[model samples]
Target: MAASGKKNNILKVLLIIVLIIGLVAAWLGYQAFMSPSIATSEDYFYVHTDEPYESVIKRIEDEGIVKNPTYFKYVAKSMDLQNGIKPGRYKLSKDLSNRRFIGNLRGGYQEAVPFRFQNLRLKENFAGALGKSFEADSTTFLNILNNETIAEKYGFNKDNFFSMFIPNTYEIYWNTKPEEIIDRFASEYKKFWNADRKAKAAALDMTPEQVSVLASIVKGEALHVDEMPEIAGLYINRLKRGMLLQADPTVIFANNDFTIRRVLNRHLTIDNPYNTYRYKGLPPGPIMMPSIASIDAVLNYNHHDYIYMCAKDDFSGYHNFAKTVAEHQINARKFQQALDARNIKK
Candidate 1:
């Protein structure tokens, strides 16, 4: 009976040891799987294309995404995250755990980047903006834009291809390829020029691209949205009369000097197709990306007889429209006097 009691006491000690081990194991499991892992300053974490797992781990540490990476690394290895690291922009909340973070990476769950672009003047500007927002560099985007074959595939030439990208906030993956981005723009361009818009373009005896070209000039000329329709009307009148557009914006574009606040006579004499003063009709392509409002203004231009325009002397960013060259000259003289008064001699 004493021997039996000793065995019972030994069993109790062993059971206590087992219970302690179980508790420690549970605590470790909870730490490894459920503890808050991410403590990032940035709301999103970017894993670049072809970036190695080691680089990503280092970035997480360097970027202060976590206080301790050891447990995260352990979870990642258990989940096989290193072998299957998906390139993407991932949203990291403060509540994300090691297991949850590794699970997202392993499952290829990534957030889409909301990319917004506007007021871009040149293809270089567009490429630079895209490069900053995506994994593809500026050179990659520029090369695709300059490729004549790709341009033709999208039903545009190199000159007019700039008009294809409509300015708006778009959702795209950070790892999206340049070709894929171009394809998305093509899809958006088609969607923007619907039946109603196409009919409006047709009524004006212009293609959608041509309308965008005129819209770009109007966008450059008018800062006020209300003035766009009237400015578009003035240019349309000049087009109807077979008169040279003589738009100062075109001369500025041809010179490639955005700093030119005042267009000089020499600027008009620039031997370039983009110089509307030298060439009749619209320029070969859009000088800049036209806003949607600017494009719509062209399609819904005011019906008027005004064929000329000069910036108002008040410097209020409005233009004075005229039916005759004499009236336009008067407006121009007043604006010139105002510019002289301000010492704007450029």
Candidate 2:
């Protein structure tokens, strides 16, 4: 009777063990099969690219976009998604398992934002605006552009720093870095400067830097692109004739204050190297970043002996080109009359 009882007890123990194993297996199978796939629009979550990875995971978990961060991290590591997950705004959901979430990220499943550059003045301004749009540090981006080491590595002189960047609308990922933005612009600039453009610049006895400087002047002077070539011609004539460019924009740049309503006689007398009236040649560097149209205009300037130009009194979007001081003075008087009539003293 004792042997039979012991056998029954061993059988019961074995049966309990089998039941426990079966329960565990069933639970694991349920977990594996019940894990959600990529979330659709109904379960979307937004993530800013600037957020750190850990912070992003926390937010995802808190927002119910992910069941657990540990599982996500484990799956991400196993799938080698550490580098594959692009940095940007993403849409995700808690129902999605780690695998699906990573796949969505890798597949660039996010909304795109538009970036436009219309009438930006300084390179810093453009960089700041772009950085804010992308959730990046604008100052950091400007530093990269102004970095001496990087500039030298990229064969950029101080004069050529912002030469290649052309303002236009761009479609970019919200998480793009400032450095990447600059790199893309620089690459685009290089592509625009083809062999024909290089030969044209060289034939005019001008380096790319000098052409860009002239282009900057053109940008500062003319509001209309149609007048750019003629405006460029006027400055080239002044340079060839050993006359001061005498551009008011250079005076404004030298003063470091663009708010002065009028270019006072004293302003011209201010002995800054950038003052074209004082300095016989182009300024040490570009006064501002120039557009591609301006640069192209300078490269293909009108071949005229015009040494001076003054804005038309009618605000006709054209200038009165002159080869003599008297002619320029007359045009200047007409412009002054127009300014006086409109009570605009600048």
Candidate 3:
């Protein structure tokens, strides 16, 4: 009876020990899927190209997503995610489990960054915008864009390179390199300059680049959309007659002072390739990033006998086009009077 009692006690102890072990196993299993791990408030995690899983773990800790880096690394290794790490942007969940986190990292589940650009003044400005949201820095992107050899590969110069970036929202990875973005732009440029546009440009004796240049000028001059085609027509007429464009916007560009509300005689004297007052043809490149609407307006310019354009004195964002110098002088004097009334002399 004593030996029987002793064996029964031993069996009870073994049962308790086994229950503890089973409970521990269940808790660990729950930790794998049910427990919350990520603590970040941000929406996503950005994994760069060629980044290792260890580096990702470090970022997880650095970003305050995971409280325990060591345990997260252990979980990642156990799930065979160390070598299966993907390079991309990933969505971050607040209540993300270890298993789901590992799965997301292992699978190339990247969030497409909403990359957008518009109304850019210079290549450096574009680079600054990109650097704010992307991994590539301003100087790095500018160097690649301004490099003669790299620009040659894309068949662009620093001057015309701004024309390639169509102002639109693009879904691209944050880790996108300069070369990849440029290639995408090149594709977009090809799509924009379709066979029909090419045919029209040929009819006008202009290349797509030349059209973009004129479009930039038209865009600079006209604030109202309805005036774009009219301004485009006047410039086309001037170009056909081999007359000087004498665009105030081109003078502003030559002066490099965007703040100059009015182009004076002094501004026109600055001799640069962009000075349409001195140069008889289109500038070497676009003065600003022209919109698609402006570009298309140039492609289908109105047939007009006008060779000059001046802003209206009423400040209606419209222009008065003229076939003779005397008419332009009349329009200019009216606008000058308006400018004088507003104390705008520059």
- The deviation in Å at residue 346 for candidate 3 is 2.3
lDDT of 3 by residue, 235-289 (tens): 8988888899888898898898999998888888988999999999999888888
**TM-scores of all predicted structures:** 0.96, 0.73, 0.89
Which predicted model would earn the best lDDT? Answer: 1
The deviation in Å at residue 98 for candidate 1 is 1.1
Each candidate's root-mean-square deviation in Å? 1.4, 6.8, 2.5
Winner on lDDT (2 vs 3)? 3
Give the runs in model 3 whose Cα sits over 4 Å from its true position.
1-13, 50-55, 67-70
306-346: candidate 2 lDDT, tens digit per residue: 88888889988688989888998999999888888988875
Superposed Cα deviation of residue 185, candidate 3 (Å): 1.2
lDDT of 1 by residue, 309-342 (tens): 8999999999998898899899999999999999
Of the candidates numbered 1 and 2, which has the greater lDDT value?
1
Pitting candidate 1 against candidate 3, the one with the higher TM-score is 1
Whole-model lDDT values for every prediction: 0.91, 0.76, 0.84
Cand. 3 Cα-lDDT: 0.84
Candidate 1: regions farther than 4 A off: 1-3
Q: How many pairs collide in each candidate, listed in order?
A: 0, 3, 0
**After aligning candidate 3 to the native by TM-score, how far in Å is the CA of 230 from where it should be?**
1.5
